[model samples]
Target: MKGRILLVEDDETFRSFLQTVLEEAGHDVLMASDGLSGARLIKGQQFDLVVSDLKMPGKSGLELFRDAMRDADPPRFIFLTAFGTVEEAVGAMKDGAFDFLTKPLEDPDALVRVVDRALEGLQRSRDYLALKESEAGGLPPEELIFAGSAMQPIRKLVHNVAGTTANVLIYGESGTGKELVARTIHLLSPRGGGAFVPLNCAAIPENLLESELFGHEKGAFTGAVQARLGKFELAKGGTIFLDEIGEMPVALQAKLLRVLQERVFERVGGGKEIRADVRVIAATNRDLAEEVAEKRFREDLFYRLNVFPVNLPPLRERRDIIPLLTEYFIRRFCRLVGKKLKGIESEALRAMKAYTWPGNIRELQNVVERAVILAQDTVRAVNLPDALVGAGGPAAAGRDKLKMVERDLIVQALEQHGGNRRQAAEELGMSRRTLQYKLKEFGLLG
Candidate 1:
C-alpha cells in the first residue's frame, strides 16, 4: 500500500538514503532532520506512518511519539536504534511503535519488508472502512437543519467521529429525531456511500424480529417458504440503524452482543456463520442505564454499544428551533400539497413556540402539515389545534396551560373507563389507535 510517510533522522546521509529507498518503493516520503521537526510536521499534516531515530538532539523519538498520540488519528510509528540500543528499541515498541529497526542497516531490504507489512495492514483497514462507507451514502453536513445551541455539540460530535469506526448510541425522547441524527452521522462518515438500513425493534413482533435481523432459510420456520436476507445482510458494507434499541428483547440482546463482539453472526435456523461488515448505530428513548440496573438490559451489551453516546435535547429545551422548523415544514408541505401559502402568520408562529412540544419535531411536522392542508393563503392561528391557541394568556406562555388541560383530559378519560383503552376511545369519540397513539405521545403509557 503506497502512502505518505514521514522520516525523521538527524544524520543527513542516512535520511537521504532512507528517503531514496522509500521513494523507489512507490511511497511518498517526507524527511525531517530532527525529532522536533518531525513532530511539527505530524501536527500540520496527515501521514500514514512515521519513521524516526530513537535518539535525537531535541524532542527524542519517544517524546515525539508521546506527542503524536494526543491526536485523534495518530500516524503509525517505527523507530531506528543502534546495535547496542536494541533493548531501548524494544521498549519503544511497547510504547506503541509500529516496529523498531537497528542502525548500520543490514539487508537494506528488511526496512522495505517492515514498511510493506505496515502499509498492507493499513490498506486492509482502509479497505474495510471504505467498503462500509461506500455503501452507506449520507447527506452533506450543510443539509441538516437546526438553530439551537443545544444541537451544536451534538453536531460537532457527529463530525468528529464520522471518519472513525466507532459504534454510536443515540439517547433521546421519542419524536426527538434520533433516527435523523443516526442518518446524519452515517452520511458524514467515510462510509457515506453505503446503505443506511433502519429497523425499529419495538415495532416488530418478538417472534419475527430475530428473523428480520438475521434472516432465515427455506422451511426454517412454519411459514418460511423461501430463503431470505436479513437487515444485517442487506446492510452489508453500510450501516444498520436499530431504533428503539432499549426495547430489544433480553434474549436477543445476547445474540446482538455476540455479533458485535465477533463481527459475525448466523442466520436464524442457519448453521453457517455470516460475516457482518456493517456498522451498527443504535438509538432509544428509554434510559438503558436504568434498564441495566433493573436487569431489563445487559450491562456488557450496553457498554459495547455505548462506545460513543450522543444525547439529543428535547424540543421543549430547544424552543428556539420551533420557528425555523415551522417555516421549513410549511414550505415542505406546501410544495407537497400544492398549497399557495406565502408564509406562517406571526400569531401561528407565536402559538407554536409557546406550546410545549411533548411530541417534539415529529409533532411539529404533523402540525405544520395539517396547517398547510387547512390554510387558504398563510397559516394562521385558526389553522392550528384549539389546544394550542385556545388558552387565555400571551400565546408564548399558554403552553403550560395547554399541557395542564391535555393532562387533565387524559386523566379524566382514563378514570372514566378504568384505564380500558377501548372504552376510553369510545368515550373520547376517537379511534382506539388514535387514543393509544395519543397516550404514548403524551407520555401517559406508564
Candidate 2:
C-alpha cells in the first residue's frame, strides 16, 4: 500500500535522491533538513513512517522521536547513520527506531523494501488502535479467533498488562499465537519501538541453543571459525521471544535463568560478559507449574519469567473465533498465492467447523493455504485434502492433511526430462502449468 513518508536530513543531495526514489515507488514524500524544523513538521503532519539522519545541526533523531511521541499518534522512525557510527544507530534502535539505514546508502532497493515494511507496520498499529477503540474493547487476542463476552476479559488483560516491561510467560497450546501475543506486547510496550527477536527452543538442537542465545567466539568449537553474536546481543534493549521454552534442555535452563536475572551472558568459550538490557518473553505449551513442581524446570527462572502470565485458549475452546479465522486465512493465503477467490463455500465452512484442530491455528492456516493452492477454481469443500474430505479417512486432520503427497517417483521422472515441464507433465500424466505450478507452489519460484 502507498503511504506518506517524512525524511529528516541536512544534506541536500541525499535528501533530494531519497525523495525522488521514494516518490517513484508511489509514496508521498515530505522533507526536513534540521531536527527543530523536522519536529515541527512531524508534530503537525500525519505521516505513515519517518526516516531521519541521526546527527543534525540542531536536535538529533533521538530528540525528535522523544518530542514527536508526545503527540497521541507518532509516526515510527527509521534512523540513518554512517558506517563507523553503528553503535549510535543501535542505541537509536533501542531507543525506539523501527530500523536504521547506514550512509552512504548503498542499496536503494533494500531502502525501499524497508520503507514498505515500516509502512505495513504503521498500518497494522493504526488498524489495531482503531479496532481496539471502535470494538467492544482492545484488539483481538493473538492466534485467538472468537468474539463477544469470552474475548472481553482477555482483551482487557492484554491491554492492562502490555505496558509493563516485566518478563511475560505465555501459556497456550501450540499455534495459539503465543508469539503474536509476545509481539503485541512489544508493539504496545515501552520497548515496542525496539526489535522483537524470536527463537524456537524446540527447533534448535540442545547443543546449539546455548550458543545461539549467547553467541560464540571464533574457534570455540570444531566448526566455530567466526565470532558470532547471539540473539540476546542482537535484541539488546528490545525483546527476545523464546517459543517452546519448555523444550529447552535442563542444563541450559541454568544459563537462561542467569541471563534472565543478570541480563548478562558469556559467548561460547569467551571470558567477557555481554550485558543486554533486553526484555524476556517466554512461551510454552506445557504447564510450567507442573514442570516446576516436578523439579524439571528451574523454579527461579520460571518465577522470573512468570511475573506476568498470559494464557491463550485453544481454537476448539474459543469456538466463536473459527469463522473469523477461516475468513482471515483464506484472504491472506489467496493474496499470498496471487489468487482472488471470494469466500469459503458453506460446505467448506461446515467441514472446517466440524474438524477438531489439534495443531490449532497454525494447522488451520496451512489447511486453508494448501486448499487454496490446490483448488482448480474457486474454493470448494472438494478442493480440500482427502483426509479432511471424508470423516472415515482419519480421526482428524493430520498436520496440513494434504490429499496427495508428491512422491519422489514423479520428481525423479521430471528430473530425468532435464527440467522440461512439457515432457515431465506428459510423463507424470498432467499439464505443463499444473506441473510448473506445483514446482512454483512448492517454493521453486524462479
Candidate 3:
C-alpha cells in the first residue's frame, strides 16, 4: 500500500513531524511550505494524494485543489484546518476535496489511519479506471457492440488469446482503440487484480522517456530530489500497454528488448536491478517491418513484441458498425453532458455513413458528442461538420477541398465558442494541439 504523497504546510516543525510519521509508515513523502509552492509541485509531478493546510500564504488549499482538478487524472486532496475554519473545510469537501482534518493533532494514529484509507481508495480508483469493463462480470458492453461481420473474428481472437500471458502487438490506425484491445486481454488474464499501466511512447520526450519506463533513484538528475517508481514498477504483476511503440526512440528500443529477454531492469542512475513480472502489449499505426527495413526501429525488439499480433480494421472497412458506434456514443455523451438527446436524424446518419472517416472511431465519437451538445432533442445535419455533409467519402474530395472544409469548421467552431481555443477544439472533436496546428496551417490564429 506504499504510495507517493505530497504534504503542504506553513508550519516548518509540523511539516517535518508529519513527514517523519508518513515515511515511517512506508509512504514516500514530498513536502512544500505553502499553497503556492505546493501548487507548483502538483503541476510538475504526479502524486497519490495531497495533504495541505486550508489557510496558507498566497493561494489557499481550495484554490490548489481547483488547479489540480484541471489535470485529466488528479490526485486525491485532504485539507487541514483550524477549529475556526471548520465550515470552510466542509465546503471544500462538498466541492470535491477528499477529506478534512482539524488542527492540533491529539491522536497520532489518526493521521496514519487517514493516510491508509486515502491510499486504499486511490488503488480502487486506479483499478476501476483501467478495468472498468473487464472487472465487471465480463468484457465491456462496447466490446460486444461491434456486431459487424468484420468484427466477429476479431472478437473471437480476443477471447481465444486473452487468457494467455504472451506479449501482444496490436496494429491499427489512430482512434481504433488499441488500448481497448489490450485492456480486454488484461482483464481476461490472470493479472486482472493488479494494475494496468499505459504509457504513450510518442507523447513523452526522449530525454525523460528512459526514466519514465525504468524509474530513477534520488539525485539521478537535476530535478531528481526524491526516488520515484516508473510505469513498469507500478504495473508489476499486471499489464503494461506501450502505446505508439513505433514512435519510441531507437536507443530506448535496446533497453526495452533487454526487458523482454531478461525480465529485469535498472533504475536510471541506480545500479540495483529490479524484477519486472508484467505482460507487455504494444500498439502502432505504422508498419514496423518497414521501419525495421529503414533502420528506424530495432529488428530484435520488433520480433520480440510481435509474438502474437492483432490487427484492427479501419472504420471505413467496417462501415456497417458506424450506426452502432454512433448510437453508443450518443447515449454516452448525452448522459455525460446531461443533454437528454434522442438520436441522430436519418439525414445526418446517411451523411455520416457516406463520409469516409479519416480519423476513424475517435473522430466519430467526437462528432457525435458535439452533435449531442448542440442538438435540441435529436441530432441533425447542422450539428455535423461541413465535410461530413453530402459526402461520398473523405477521400472522394481532393486534399485541398478537405483542407478548406476543415478550416471552415475550425473557424465556425471558434466563432461559436467566442474564440476560446479549448472549447472550440472540444466542439470540433479534436485536441487543443491539433486545433493549434490547424489554426497555424490555415492562418486563422492572428
Q: Report the number of the highest-TM-score candidate.
A: 1
lDDT of 2 by residue, 1-446 (tens): 58788989999999999998899999999999889999889877788788999888889887898888777878888888888778988887786778998899988988899998998777677546644542233224444432534656766777677777788888887787777777777766666657789999999998899999999999999999999999999898788999989888889999998887787889999999899889888999776776686677988888988998987876767666777887777777776779888778888777777766667788888888888887766678887766665543345444324523564545676689986656888998988546644563343434
| lDDT (10s digit) by residue, model 1, range 270-382 | 99999999999999887688679779899999999999999888898898888878777787787777877889888888878877677888888898889999999899999
Give candidate 3 regions above 4 Å deviation: 1-146, 393-446
By TM-score, is 1 or 3 better? Answer: 1
Ranking by lDDT: 3, 1, 2
Which of candidates 2 and 3 is the stronger one according to TM-score?
3
- The TM-score values for the models, in the order shown, are 0.61, 0.59, 0.60
In candidate 1, how many clashes are counted? 14
Q: If the candidates were sorted by their TM-score against the true structure, best first, what order would they fall in?
A: 1, 3, 2
Q: Give the TM-score of candidate 2.
A: 0.59
lDDT of 1 at 115: 91
Q: Which stretches of candidate 2 lie above 4 Å from their native place? A: 1-149, 390-446
Residue-level lDDT for 413 in candidate 3:
94
lDDT of 1 at 65: 92
